[model samples]
Target: MTELDEPASAGPAVQLALRELGILLDKRVWAPGSRLPGERALAGQLGVSRSSLRQALAMLESEGRVHASAQRGWYVTTSVVSEPPSILKSFTDNARERGLVPTGRVLHRRVRPAAYEESRRLRIAPAAEVLEIARVRGLDTVPVCFETTVLVRARAAGLESVDLTDRSLFATLEEVAGVRVLRSAYSAHADAADAEAARLLGIPVGSPVLVGEEITSDQEDTPVLLCRSVYRGDAYRFEATLHRSPD
Candidate 1:
């Protein structure tokens, strides 16, 4: 029998660790509406910071795992997948807090001249330098997205300076590199997953995918990330709250 490679852990520490309590409850560690242990107690049992512990609890609350009574604390919310998308406020932290393993492996990270297409979109000088990063991202060991990102290297110098793994793309840009993403335009299309995508996505060749292209800009209106992401349609659902005035 072939052994699969062990997946990456969320790393050491309680607040940031893989507090599987969320998934555990999903897998029936506790029934619906069951009251979980208290925060201080759970922090003690898990050997983590109260903040980290609270993060997990917050995720559970978001998913309906626990509810809060004024004087009391949170209790169970639901049994099925109540976890929300990472796009809410701090999606990355929320997803991690809920025990949904998020991993990004660099397929290629390099510095290259901007492509003609990029030059046209970013309005940069032809042959301008840009940072290119491609990653195969997974959710709980399931490959679900292929992210190919490009950025203008001049406006934001220090290309290839920080660790891409173990960090959020936008966070690293905003915090370490001082390149805060301010605006973005995204467009999605229906396409088939290629062999490389299939290998990463655990699906048959030519599987359906939502090809999303996004161009993110800084507060100064300089382009930050020109990203092309192929997300597994089976693994993702885009949601929104559309308010319509009653006719």
Candidate 2:
């Protein structure tokens, strides 16, 4: 009689190493944000060759179990998906929705004249006054994004006096100035963190990041805010639901 067929699998040696690596990850031997050991050391510890170890790591990365940072090394990517809100909301609100305690550190804030690029994006005249603010936003101790925003000063009056570190920008705007954000149009790109971005995010220089440039508008579609931000790539994933209409 023919025997029952067994499931096809990876080569025995590679499978053994993959199993061991999976065990380490499942046991939480490495905490999130902690960098993994070098390939040589990890391979030696796991009784595998460097190539085999790399194969296993690649598999983990595809599964969202690990992340490789540029010029640095591999780290455990946070399981949390970093998709933004469907409706207009502030960073504080976004973090809370993901079960994180949000915090912001104001880096700079001042009145600045809009440059040509800023003016075009915000639909304002060149050299118009604007309130510029830069901040580093985080969840607990993990710094995620460095954001800079430019607001039309005439629409954001008294904003300089707001305690930004503890307040929600959206809430403050609506409450203080009676201005509401209707929506934002933005684009995202893959990028490497520069020196300043790396310092603020606590990552090595040249680490991967997602740069977002956005223009926010009010109920009447008048542009009110211009924002540029770099989010840590390892800690966030962007997802969207898409549909195609009948052809």
What are the per-model C-alpha RMSD values against the true structure? 14.9, 6.2
lDDT of 2 at 167: 67
lDDT of 1 by residue, 22-111 (tens): 566658665443456776676666666556666666665665456554445655543221224324222245447767767677788899
lDDT of 2 by residue, 19-64 (tens): 8988998887886667889877887897766666777788888888
TM-score of every candidate:
0.61, 0.75
- Structure candidate 2, residue pairs in collision: none
lDDT of 2: 0.80
Residue 102 error, candidate 1, Å:
1.7
lDDT: worst 10-residue window of model 1: 1-10
Candidate 1, residue 160: Cα displacement in angstroms equals 0.8
Instruction: Indicate which candidate wins on lDDT.
Output: 2
